[model samples]
Target: MITLDFDGFKSEIETPSEDLRIYNFWATWCAPCIHEMPYFESVVKDTKGTNLVFVSLDDDRRPERVKAFVEKKGFSSPIWLLSEKEQKDWKQKLKEDWSGAIPATLFVTAAGKRHFHTGQISEEKLKELIETYK
Candidate 1:
C-alpha cells in the first residue's frame, strides 16, 4: 500500500495505462463505504487484468487503523491513503463533478477515458463499466 498526497494522486490519475484502473474512495467510518466494500472485493476477485486501488479517506492521524482494517478485510488490492487535508482544494482537481463523497469511484481506461461515480456501486454496475473500458 502507498500513501499519496494530492499532487501524487493527480499525477496518477493523469497518467495513462493499458489496464483498467478503479479508484475507490472510502473511509472506515462510513457505513455506505463499508457496505459496498464486499462488492468491490468481489470485483477485484473476478476482474483479470485491472488495477483496484482502495483510496482511503480516513484521518491522517489514524494510519494504523486503516492498515488494520485493510488487513482484517483481507483485501489484496493495492490500498492507498489519501494524505491531503484540504479536500475542497483537491476535489475539483480529481473531477469537476466530484462532491467528495465516500464510496465514490473513478474509472480510468487505457485510452484515457474517465468515468466518475459518487455513491455506492453494485457489482453488476462495476462489471458493466469494466467491460465498457476493457
Candidate 2:
C-alpha cells in the first residue's frame, strides 16, 4: 500500500495503460464503504489483469488509523491514503459529477473509457461494470 497526495493521484489517473483500473474511494469511518469492501475484495481475488486501488479518504492528521484499519481488515488490494487537504478542488478534478462522496468508484480502461459511480456498489453490479471492459 502507498500514500499519495493530490498530485500523485492525479498523475496516476492521467497515465493511460492497457490494463483496467478501478479506483475505489473509501474511509475507515464510512460504514457503507466498509460494508462493500468484502464484495470488492471477492471480485479482486477472482479477477485477473485488473488493477484494484483502494483510495482512503481518511483525514490527513490520522493516517495511522487508516493504516491500522486496512491491516485489520486484511485488504489485499493496494491501498492509498489521500493526503490532499483541498477536497473540493481535487474532487472536481476527479469528476465533475462527483460530490465528494464516500464509496465512490472510478473505472478506467486502456481504451480511454471512464466510468464513475457513487454510493455503495453491489457485487453483481461491480461484475457487470468490469465485464464492459472485458
Candidate 3:
C-alpha cells in the first residue's frame, strides 16, 4: 500500500485522466467501512475501464494494522494510507460537503465530472454509480 500526505492525495484526485477513478475513504476500525469493502472489491473485479483505490484513513503511525488487515482480506485494488493526522481541512478539500465520514466515496469520471457520497453504498448502487460515471 502507498502512503500519501494531503498534497499528494490532492494531486492524485486533481490530475486529469481518461479513466473513471473511484476513491474509497475508509479505516481498519470502521465497521461500516469493513462491511462495504467486499462490495467494493466485487465491483473492482467485475468492472472494466474503472479504477478503484482504497484510501485508508487509519493513523499514519500505525499503518501496520491497516497493512495486516489488507493482507488478511486479500484486496486486489491499490490501497493508500493518508499521512495527515488531521482531516478537518483536507476532508473539505476532498469534497466541500463531506462530513468526514467513513465509507465515503469520491467518483471522478473520464470526462472530469466528480461525485461524492458520504455513507455506505449498497452493491447495486455501486454498480449503478459506475455505470453512470463510466
Candidate 4:
C-alpha cells in the first residue's frame, strides 16, 4: 500500500519507467466519490504490485474534509488535493470537453497509452485491471 499527497504525485508517477498508473480523481464533497474511495483502497491493499493514486480535486477550501475522509476510510494509497492550475491543465490535457468532473479515473502506461472511466468503479473491475497488467 502507498500513501500519496498531492505534492508527491507527479514525481512518483514520472519516476516509474513503465508502471501502469491508475489515477482516480475525486472530491471531498461528492457523495459518489467518497463512497467509492474505500473500495479503491481495498483493491490496492489486496493487490501486491500495481500502482494506484487518488487525486483529490478539492482545493485548500476543503482540505479538512479531504483529510478527514482519507483518515476515516483508512486509505492506503496515494491521495492528493490538486492545484487549480493543475486541474485546469489536466482537464485540457485529458479531454477538452471534460467539465472537470469528479470520480473520473485514468489508467495509463508510462509511455502514455490511456484508458478512461468517467464514473464510479467496482472492486472486481479494479482487480481485473490490476491483474491484466501484471
Best by lDDT: 3
lDDT of each: 0.84, 0.85, 0.89, 0.72
After superposition, the stretches of candidate 1 with alpha carbons farther than 4 Å from their true spots are none
Where does the lowest 10-residue lDDT sum fall in candidate 4? 1-10
Model 3 lDDT at residue 52: 89
- lDDT for each residue of candidate 3 in 1-134, tens digit (9 for 90 to 100): 98898899889888988789999999998999999998898886788888889999988898889989999998888999998675767888777777788889999998778999989999999999999889
Candidate 4 regions exceeding 4 Å error are: 1-12, 110-112
Instruction: State the displacement of the C-alpha of residue 116, model 1, in Å, after optimal TM-score superposition.
Output: 0.4
Tell me the tens digit of each residue's lDDT in model 2 across 48-133: 86788899888877878988988898988888888757666889878987789889999988776788899999999999888887
User: Candidate 4, after superposition: displacement of residue 56 in Å?
Assistant: 0.3
Query: Which rank order by TM-score, best down to worst?
Result: 3, 2, 1, 4
Q: Tell me the tens digit of each residue's lDDT in model 4 across 1-134.
A: 23344345556555655667788988878898888888887777766655778887877555677788788877877776666546656576565567777788877766656677788878887778766655
* Predicted model with the maximum TM-score: 3
Find the 10 residues in a row with the least total lDDT in model 3: 84-93
Better of 2 and 4 by TM-score: 2
Tell me model 2's lDDT, rounded to 2 decimals. 0.85
Q: RMSD to native for every prediction?
A: 1.4, 1.3, 1.2, 3.6
